[model samples]
Target: MSERKQRADATRNREAVLAAADALFARSESPRSVSMDEIAAAAGVGKGTLFRRFGDRTGLIQALYEARVQPLREAVESGPAPLGPSTPPLERVPALLDAMLRFKMDNRHLSMALEEAGSGSPYAAGHYTRWHSDLEEMLRQIPATATTAGFTAHALLAATRADLVEHLLGEQQMTPEQVRQGLAGHIARVLGDHGND
Candidate 1:
């Protein structure tokens, strides 16, 4: 096949793998049990193809997460009010955090699976840096927090980490609304009255 054709085929295969994995994860009560073998079979590709295309289970999970969060990332990057660049820093910070929390809650199983895959510290992930930087910049805009923005941003993001989210919903048996309200209360305390702005 020509190089262009080969590239097109590869893209199609990649999409098929991602789609199959997404479906499997979505359907499974235990996402971690949805193995590479099952994903390969569902995608109509060999197990070898899966390894070759994605390196390993962690890589595949990371890719899926990145793909899933792309929309949220775009919204935060430039989409509109609340999350967009136009919002005031205090309001934007809480909004961004609430959005992240909601994504984790909505994708609880998948998020837990990704975390269990031992992909290493989430701080090392590229997406984490983007979130941290955006949050840190916002925190810096508040004169009272200028000096601690970096630490504060990381701390805030840490609250929404997948494991913690899972623990709250799974172990603590907190309803999603309770979790949201709790986070809002925590954020309000952290940001003072400015958070509701």
Candidate 2:
């Protein structure tokens, strides 16, 4: 096959795998219960192909997580308003954090699986660095937070960690809206604002 055809086939196969994995994870009561074998079968690809495409389950989960959140990332990167760069640091900080929390809430099972995979530290993941760096920059723009921006960014992100999200939504039975409101309040307190903004 030509290089172009080869590339096209690879892309198709990759999408198929991701779609299958997404469906399986979404339907399973437990994301971790969805195995590589099952994903391969559902995607109509060989086990070797899955391994070659994603390295391992950890890599697959990571890719899926990234794929799932790409839309949000793009919005924050270049979209408009609350999430876009044009927004003020004071307003944008909480909005950015809220977006992250909402994503965790919406993709709880997948997020949990991704967090529990690999080194068990989502902080070490590639996407985490991008988010942390962006938030750190945003925090730095505020006079009050500029000094402790790095630490503050990490701390705020910790509030949306997968395990905590799971606990808040699962064990604590907090609705997604309630959790978002609580996070907003906490972020406001951290920012020395009343969070009503």
Candidate 3:
């Protein structure tokens, strides 16, 4: 095969693996139960291919999680109001929290997998650091939170953690709307009116 064809095949295989892993995690009772062999078979690729491409199970899960969150990242990085960098901090803080909450709710399994991956704390994950940094920067712009931005960012993110989301949705039976409203109220209390609701 030509170089271009080889690249295309590799790309297709990678996507296929991600999709298969996503499905497996979504329906899995426990993320740990979904093995690399299952993922390889589901993707119709050789087991060696999965190892070669992703390094290991944690690496594959991280890549899949990153792929899933790419659109949200883009919106937060460059899209319009509320999520974009151009939005006012007062509005952006709540918007960012809400978006993240929704993301965790929507991708509970995958988020859980990524969070539980490896022996390190989830707070040490690259994605967590990026989100915390973004949130802290926005918080610093709001006078009310500026003094405690770092701690506030972490506290706010804790509200949207995968395990918390799963508990609210699964055990407490809170609707997505309820969780969102609760978060909005919490943020409002933190930010106050300040000419921006």
Candidate 4:
């Protein structure tokens, strides 16, 4: 094979390994459940190739998380009317939360593991940190404040965590729409705090 062909094969090998890792990790967050050998077998590459590309389990986890979240970020940044850049910033807040909740529901276990992992691993750390930054950016765009807004964006997100949301919608038997409306009311009150009588 030519040098270019060799490079192309390597690229394919790396992509395959990441895809395999994402699937296995999505099912279970146990890094031990997966091994470079299994990943190589799944990818149709040698174990050495998998190691060369990803260094170790941590590197694989980081790549899988990045691959998973990059599309989500892009979807928020430029996919649809509300989520994409089309809607007003204020309108985007509830919509953003709704989208986020849907994502959590879709990838429940992975989401749970990632949340539990916290900043202990990059895979988990990025999502946790990004939430704060995401909240801050949204507040800035809406021109709300941590102080005068009645609650910090971070506070709102913490309240809206999947566990809390499940407690409300699932355990409490509240409808999804009702939860959304409640959240909206909370946000409205917070925003109203800065307004003069």
Lowest lDDT sum, 10 consecutive residues, model 4, at 115-124
Tens digits of per-residue lDDT for model 1, 7-57:
998899899999999889888877878989999999999999899999998
- lDDT winner among the candidates? 3
Candidates 1 and 3 compared by lDDT, better number: 3
Scored by lDDT, model 2 comes in at 0.90
Query: Candidate 2 residues 42-95, lDDT tens each?
Result: 999999999999999989998999898999999899989899999999989999
- Which candidate, 1 or 2, has the higher TM-score? 2
Which residue window of length 10 is worst by lDDT in model 2? 188-197
lDDT per residue as tens, model 4, 92-147: 76677667766665554445545544246432465666765665677666654634
* Off by more than 4 A, model 3: 193-197
The top-ranked prediction according to TM-score is 3
- What lDDT does each candidate get? 0.87, 0.90, 0.92, 0.66
* Model 1 stretches with alpha carbons more than 4 Å out: 2-5, 27-31, 193-197
The number of clashing residue pairs in each candidate reads 0, 0, 0, 0
